[model samples]
Target chain A: MLYIDSISKGIVIDHIRAGAGFSIFKYLDLDKADFTVALIINAPSKKLGKKDLIKIENKIDLDLAMLGFIDPNITVNIIEGEKIVEKINLSLPRRVEGIIECKNPRCVTSMERNIVHKFVLMDEKDGVYKCEYCDQIYSWEG
Target chain B: MLQGKHLIDPEDFSIEELGSILELAEDMLNNQAKFKDVCNGQILGTLFYEPSTRTRFSFEAAMIRLGGRVIGFAEPGSSSVMKGESIPDTIRTVASYVDIIAMRHPKEGAPKYASYYSPIPIINAGDGGHQHPTQMLTDLFTIKEVKGKLSNLTIGLCGDLKFGRTVHSLIKAMSRYENVKFLLISPNELQIPEYIRTEILANKDIPFTEVERLEDVIDSLDILYMTRVQKERFFNEADYIRLKDSYILDKEKLKLAKDDLSILHPFPRVNEISYEIDEDPRACYFDQLKYGMYVRMALIAKLLGVA
Candidate 1:
C-alpha cells in the first residue's frame, strides 16, 4: 500500500532484510552522495515477510560484494528509461579488503598500522569467511 | 614445485610436495655431508619479531649447516620494528639482503603478511597460536621416519588442543593421508577449536573422539603427541590441581601404551612429560627436536632451489 516514484535510470536494491536497510544506506554513502535515494523500510515482501528497499534516482557504481556481504539476498536492478535493463545477482564475495576485521587480538592485523583487513570466502553455503593473515574463522550472518 | 613458496599453512603443499620435502629430509639425514655446501652463496634472514630462542636457533642452524649465513634480530627492540615500521615494509627491506627469510612473531599470520610483500621466500617459523607449518613438518617427519608410514594409524593429540597451532596444522596435513584417525585428549576448557572440528575433521568424515582423560585412551594410540596444558586454562585452582596430573606421561602411564608406540612432543616442555619418561625407547622428542632442524634445512633448500 506504500507508493514511491520510480527512477528512469538508476538502480533498485530490493529485498534487503528489514533491519539491515540502514547499514546498506551507510555502506552506499547515500546520505552524502550528490543524488536522490529513497529508502523504503519494512515493506511487505513475497520472499521475505518484510524487507527494506533502496531506490537510487541516478546511476552509480556500487560495491556489489559489500552489498552482498551486507545481505546476499539483495537484488540489484539497473533501470533505463523506467525499464529494468540489467540485474546483478550477488553471492558471498571471494575477497573483501578493508572490511570484516580480524577480531583475534593476537592476529597480525591487530599489531600493525595502515594494513588493510582482508577476508576470503571459504564456504559459500555455510557463509564461512577466513582472515587471510591469521586464519581466524568469521561467519557472515547472512 | 616448492621453490620460492611460502609455507604459511600445512595445506600450502600437497601430499606429494610434503612427501617430497620429507623424503628429501630423510635423504639429507642419511647423507649429511653431501648437503654441506648446497647453499654456500645464500643468506637467510632470521626475523624473530618476538623472542623464540628454540625456533630461531633451529632456522639459523639449518641454514648454517647448508653452508649459508644468518642475519636478523631476536627481538623487536633490536630491529626498526620498534619505531613502527610495518611488517610488509620491514620484509621488503630485509628481502634485499637475504635469499629467503624465516620469521616468527607473536602475532598470528605475521609471516603470511610478510610473504605478501616479500620478494624472497618467506618461511613462517611460528605465528602466535596460529599455524606453525614447520613444526608440523617436523612432526610428520618424525612420525613417518619412526612408523615407516603416515597413514593407517591413530594419532593421539594430548593437551591444549584448542590453542596449539602445531596440533591444528598437523591434523590438517595428516588428514590428507589415507585412514589417519585422530584421538583428541584435552580438558573441557582446552578442547580443539570448533572451526577445526567442523571444517577439517567432521567435514572430511575423519574419525575422531574427544576425551578429557588420557589414561582411558593411552593404549589405543599409535602415536601420542603431547603438548603442555597450562594451569591458567582451567576455571579455578581446584580444577587445575584436580586435572593437572592427568596429562603427564609418566612411566606408569607409558606402560599402558602400545609396545611400538612413538611418543612425540614439541619441546620446551613444562611437566607434560615427566623427566622419568626420558629414558624410554619411544621418547622421540629429542630426536623429533633434531628433525625440526633437518626439516628446516630441507625446507630452506627447497625454497632456495639449492638441493
Candidate 2:
C-alpha cells in the first residue's frame, strides 16, 4: 500500500473524477509549483469507485470558476493546523474567463491577440455554457 | 447620454435610447440641412475587413451627409491587416485618427473584440452570422416609419430564418416592445435556431408560431420581413428545389396579403422576393434602404454626441 502524508496547512482538492486530476493540476498551474504538491490518481473512494486527489503544501487562490466548470462534484478542503478549516462545494460559475478555449474557428478569439476566452453560464440545469463572443453553445459534458 | 459607447448587440441600448435615435432620424429625414453640419469636424473610420457594398456605402453616405469626413479601408487586403497586423493594433491605430468607427468583419465578435481596444465608439456593422445591430436599427426604423409603430403588430419573418442574423436581431429587438407576435416562415432545414426559439421567444413569453408556408401566413401579418432563402443552405438539391418555391414572395402570394402590409427586405435580395412585386405599393424595401442610411446618420451623430 502506498501512503501519502497530508499537509498541515494548504488546500486539498478532492473528488476529482478518476482520470481528470492531470487536467486540474495543469489548470491550477500546480505542475510548476516549487512547494510540496502531490497528484494522486485513482484513489479509492466509497462515493466514487475511484477518484483523483491533489494535496498542496502552499496556500494559493484556487480558481473557483475553473474548478466549478471542470467538475462541480469536486470539493476544496482548506486545512490549518492539521485540521480542515473550511470546505467549499463547487457550483457552476456565472461567468468564466481564460479557462475553456472556444473551438469555433470563425470566432474573434481565433484571430485576436491577447483576448480572453469568455463563457457565460446560460443553462444551469443542463450545465450549458455559451461563448460570450461568438454565442456558441458549449455542452459541459464534452 | 449615448456618447462614446460601442453598439455590439441589438440589446446594448435601452428602449428609450433606441426611440431617441429613431426620433432623431425622423427629425433628420424631415429637415436634412438642419443636421447637415452636426458632425462637421468629426471623422468616421469605416474598417470593412470583409467585402460589403450596402453597409459600407450607407455608413459613408451617412457620415458625408452629416458633413463628417470619412477615412479607412474597404477591405483588409488594402490595409496593414494584410501585413499580419492584429485587430487591436488596427483598431488602436485607426481610432486615433477618427472620432468613431463603423466596422464589418467576417468573424463573429470581431467588432466586440475591437471595442475592447478601441478608444472611440465601435459600431458593429455586421459580424459573421452572429450580430448586425445597425441593420437591426435600420429595420426597426423602417418598421416605425412605414407601419407607424414598433409594437402591437404581427410581424411575419420569412425565408432563411436559421442563418438570418438580421431576422434574429429584429426579433430580439422587437421583443422589447408590447404585443409583437411572430410568424416564422421557413423550410424545416432552415427554421429559426433552437436557442432563439427557446431563449428569446419562449423565455420572454412572446407569441410565435413556426410555419413552413409563407402564403398561409402572409394575409395575417401587418409586416412581412423577407430574407433570402439560399439554395446552398440545403443538404441536397432535391430538397432545395422542392422547398425553395414555398418561400418565394410572388404576385400570387402578395394577392393574399393585407393591402397595408408593409414589406421590408435587407437589399441585394435574391429570387426569394420576385422582382415583379417591387413596384407594389406595399413594397417599402427601397424606402427601407434609405431609412437604413438615415438610421445610420442618427447612430453616428448619437455615438459622436452630436445629435
Candidate 3:
C-alpha cells in the first residue's frame, strides 16, 4: 500500500519478482548513486500480483540488457517533465561481461587471477544464459 | 589463426585440423627423442579451476618431457581468484607470462572465454560434463596406435555414457572416421545425451545401436571402452548398488570378447574392471595413459606452430 508521490523525471522499473528488486539495487549500484531512489517490495500489481518496483528520481544511465538478465519481465519507464518519455521492454543480452560471477566451480575463471566471466543469452523465454566457454546454461528461477 | 583459438568443444576443430594434429601426433610419437626439446625455454601454464590430478599431471608431464617449464595453480583457493578476480582478467594476466595454457574448469566454455581475451593459445583440459578434447586426442591416438586404423571397426562404449565427458568426445572424434559403428552399452539412466545422438551420430548417418547390457554383445566388439559408473551419478545408494556390479568387467565378460580386442579406459577407475583382466594382453588402459602424454606433446607443438 506504500506508493511514492509522482516524480517529475527519472525511471520506474516495474514487474520485478517480489524481493528481487534489492538485487537490482545492488547490481546497478543504485545505493551509491546521487539520485533519489525508492524500492517498493511486495507491491500488488494487476500484471504481477506481488511484485517489486524501483523508482529513481534522476536521469541516470542504465544498461537495459543487464536489466533483462536481472529480470526479463521488468519494464523500464523513463519519465521527463511528469510524462513518459521512453519505455524499454526488456530483452536478454547477447553477452554479459564481468557483471555476474559464474556459479560453476569448474569454470576457468575460478582459477585464473584476472579473467572475467562472460555468458551469452541463449533462451530468453526460459531465462537461460550459456557460458561462452563451457556452454553450461544458467536459468533464472521463478 | 591458432593463436586465439579456444578449444571449448571438440567440434571447434574441423576434421582437416584434427587430421593435421593427428599427423603431427604420429610424427612426435615416432621421433620422441628428436622433438624432446622442441618447447625448451617456453613455459606452459596449467590453470585447473577444478581438482583433476590425472589431467593436470598429464599436461605437466607432457610439457616437462618436451623440455618446457610449467607454472600455475591447480586449485582456485590458492590463487588470487579467492579474492574475487574475474576469469578474463586472470587469463589475460596469465597469457602475458606463458606461451600456452591448458585449463580445466567445472563450467563448460570457461576456456573459450579465456581464449577470447588471451594473447596465447587456450587448450581446454576438461569442462564439466561438456567436452574433453585432449582426452579424445589421447583416445584417438591410442586407438590408431593399437588397432592401426581409425575405421572399419565396431567400438563398444560401456558404462555411464550420460555423464562421461570422455565418451562424448570419443564418439564425436570417431564419428569423423569411415566405416565406424558404435555399440553403446549403458543402463537406461546413463544413455548418451540426445545432442550427441542427433547432432553428431544420427545426423551424420553413422550406424550405431544402444543396449542396456554389456554382456549381451561383449563378444562382437573390436574395441571395448570401459568407463566407471560413479556412485554419485546414481540417484540413491540402492540404485548404485543394483547397477554397479552389473557393469563391472570381469574375466567372464572378457572371455566372450575377441582375443585381439583392445580395451581402453581413461583411468582412476573404482572397480569397473577387475584386476584379473589386467593380466590379459588386451588391457591397454595403462598404454593409453602413455599415449595421452605423447598426444598432448603433439598438440602443444602443433598449436605452437613448431611441429
Candidate 3 per-residue lDDT over residues B29-50, each given as its tens digit: 7888988888899899999988
lDDT of 1 by residue, A37-104 (tens): 99999999889999999999998889998888988888999999999999988778899889778898
DockQ of each: 0.78, 0.64, 0.31
TM-score of chain A of each: 0.94, 0.87, 0.85
Q: Name every residue pair that clashes in candidate 2.
A: none
Rank the candidate models, highest DockQ first: 1, 2, 3
Model 1 bad stretches (over 4 Å): B230-246
> lDDT tens digits, residues A80-116, model 2?
9989999998888899899888887778988777889
**lDDT, candidate 3, at B132:** 89
- RMSD of each candidate? 2.1, 2.7, 6.2
Docking class of 2: medium
Candidate 3 global Cα RMSD: 6.2
Return the TM-score for each candidate structure.
Answer: 0.95, 0.91, 0.71
The Cα local distance difference test for each model comes to 0.88, 0.89, 0.83
Q: How accurate is candidate 2 locally (lDDT)?
A: 0.89
